[model samples]
Target: METTALSQDEVLSLIVSQLAAYGFSQLAQTVAEVTGAMVELAPSSRLSELLYLGKEQDESEELEPTEFPTEEDQDEPMEGSTDSYSKYLDFDIETKPIPRPFPDYTQLYYTQHKGPCRCAAFSADGKYAATGSHDTSLKVLDVAKMKNRSGDAGDKPVIRTLYDHVATVNDLSFHPNGLVLASCSDDQSIKLFDLSKPGVKRAFRYLQDTHIVRSICFHPSGDFILAGTDDNSVRIYDVKTFQCYTTPPTTADLHRGGITQVRYSSTGALFATSSADGSVKVWDGVSGKCVRSIENAHAGAPVSSVRVSRNGKYVLSAGRDSFIKLWDVGSGRELVRYEGAMHSRESLQAAFTHNEDFVLMGDENSYTVLCWDTRTGALVKKIQGMLLFIIQLRW
Candidate 1:
C-alpha cells in the first residue's frame, strides 16, 4: 500500500478546523496564531454589534448571544431549489458572506529563487510534490518535511531539480504507481523521471513530437500518456516505445483555437477536454469518440480548465469569463453557475472538495482565495494571503 505523510502545518490546520467546528473560537484563534493563519469570522459577521447591548456586558454574555435570522433566511425556499449557487460572476450586490474557517490552505515558495511555479503535480503516494517554473526547470519536494524556510540545509522544501526542459515547464503528471513522473514544457518535449534510479533522472527516451503541450495525464495503467496541445489535438504515446500509438485528434483545427486542458474521470472510463472554443467534451479514452459535449460552456471566453468530481457524477469547469459551471455528467446538462465571490482577471483554476460540499478557487483579480457553498451559491469565505502572483494552486 502507498503511504503519504502529513506535514506539520496540515496537522495544525486540521486541529484549528476541528476547534472552529466545535465553536471554540478563542481556541481556534490561538491555534491560528501558532500556525500563522488567523482563524477569524467573516468580516460581515463582525460588521455590527447589538446596539441594544450595554457596554458593561461581560465577555461570557457576548459569547452565548443567539444568532439573529439573516434577511434572506426569512424568505421561502424556491419551488424546486432550497438554495442558490447558480448566479453569474458579478459583485455589484452588497450582501453578508457566511463564515468559513478552512486552515488547510497555504502558499509555498523558495526563499532563494522565489520561483514562479507555473504548474505542479503531486505524486500518487502523496509523498512528493513537483513544481515547474519559468526558470526552465522542475523541482521535487519532500512533502512530509515542508516547513517554514529558514535558509538552512534542511529548511528548504525542495529535494531535487531536473534540468531537461529548455523553456518554461508547463505541466506535470505522475504515473498512478508513483514510480515515474512526466513533465512537459514550452520547448515541446515531454520528459519522464525514473524515481527508482540511484540518482534522480529522466527516462532514457523522451517524447519529442508535440506542439507546446499545455496539459498531460497518464493512462491509469501507467503505460500510455495523453497530452493536450496548442495545435488543438490530443495525442496518446507509449511510455516505453516513445512512439505515438494513435492518430493525434485535433479539436482546434475547426475553429476551437487550442486545447486548454484534458482530465480523465476518476474511474478512467471517460476523459474530458476543454478548449479555447468555449466547449467541454467528454470522450472515450481508447476509442477517441466524443461521449458528451457542452457547447458554449462559457460562451464568452475559452474554458481554461476542467475537473470531474471524485464520484464522477459532476463536471466542473472554469473559464476566461470569470465563471465556473457545474454539470451533471450523465445528461450533459448545466446544473449550476458558481459565481459567488470570484472576480479573477487571471486564468481561473478550481477544484471540488473531497466531499463536493464546497468549491475553492484562485481569485487572481482580487488577490485572495474564495470558497463557495455548493448548495447555496454564496461566497462564505475570503481567505487572506500576501502573494503578488499565485502562479499555481493545488488541492
Candidate 2:
C-alpha cells in the first residue's frame, strides 16, 4: 500500500486543529520556518476567499496601488483642528531642523520589566501607564514619577504589579473612564483591573476567549470592549452584561486571517481592523458592516496594525512590507506613505502623534523607534536603546 504526501493546506489545517501535547508544536514550528506561514487558513474555505487565491487575484488588480506623494511636496493639511495642522505645511523639510517640541524626549525614563514588555497603554487622563509583559505580569506606573529603573526611583514609581495570567500578555487597553484597565493574554483570557483601587493582586473581572486574544480596544463610551483574536474574528463584549455582541451575518464579512489590530475612530462612529490577509477594513460602528475595504493594502503583505486618526479623517496602517501608509477615511484613498523601518517580521503597532504631526512605529530589525514627519514623509527622528524587539509603541 502507498500513502500520499500531505499538501500544504492539509498540513496547515492539521496544525490549526491539533492540541498542544500531540507534537503539534514541533510540526507547527517546522511549517512556519519553511513556509513563513503567518496564519493557517484552508485553501477552499470561505475565509481563504479573502486571500484572492488563484483566479480571484485578477479582481484585485483593478484596485491599483496608491501613488505616494513626492517627499518634498506637502499637500493641504489634513482636515483637523487649527493647531499645528498648518504650522508645518510650509516648513521646508529639506532645510528645517527637525522640530524640537520636547527637548527632554530623548532622555529615557526607563521602567524595567523582568520580561520583554509586549503591550502597553496609557490611561485616558495620561496620569498612569500600564505595561504587560511575557513574564505574565502587568505593571501600572505613575507616569510623572517614573524614573530610570536602575536609578533612585527603582521600582518606587510602580503603582501596582499584578500577576494573573499564566501566559504572555499580548495587548492592553484602558477604558475611557480612566479608572479601569483591561489586558488580554495568550492564555486565552482578558482581565480587567480597577485602577482606582490599590493592593489588588488579581483582576476584578475576567473574560475568556476560544483563542489567543491578540489585540483589544475600548469603545469611546466605555460601554463595550472590542477584541481581535486568533480565531479570525473581531468580538465586541458588553461591559455590563459581559455578553459578546459581535455577530457577522455572512462568511464573506469575516476576516480570512487572524486580526492583528482593531481600533475605533475618535468619535466611535466607526472602527478599523487589520488582518494577516493583507487587508484593512473600516466598519460602521453601529451596524458592524464593512463600510470600506482596502484589499492588498500592503501588496499582499500582512498588515500588522491600523489606527484611526485623531481627527477621524484618516487611517494609518503598518504592514510587513516595511511601509506605513495613511488613508483618507471618506474617500478610501491612500494619502501618504512612510518607509525606512525594517518591520517585515513582527506584528508591530504604529501610532500618530497627539497632534497628528508625525507618524511613529518600531523598527524590529534595529530595535529602535522610528518617527517620520507626517506631511513630508521625511525621517524626523530615530530613538534607540532596546535590548529586544519593540512589540508595541504609544506616544
Each model's lDDT: 0.66, 0.75
Instruction: Give candidate 1 misplaced runs (Cα > 4 Å).
Output: 1-115, 147-152, 201-203, 245-255, 340-345
Q: Estimate, for each residue in 213-258, the C-alpha lDDT of model 2 and write its tens digit.
A: 9889998778778899887778988888899977376687788888
Instruction: State the lDDT of candidate 1 residue by residue for 3-95, as single tens digits.
Output: 576666655665665444333457767878876964342111111122112232353254543488532233323344323222211122314
Candidate 2 yields a Cα-based lDDT of 0.75
Give per-residue lDDT, candidate 2, residue 287: 62
Segments of candidate 2 deviating more than 4 angstroms: 1-104, 147-155
Error of 2 at 217 (Å): 0.6
Q: Of the candidates shown, which would achieve the greatest lDDT relative to the real structure?
A: 2
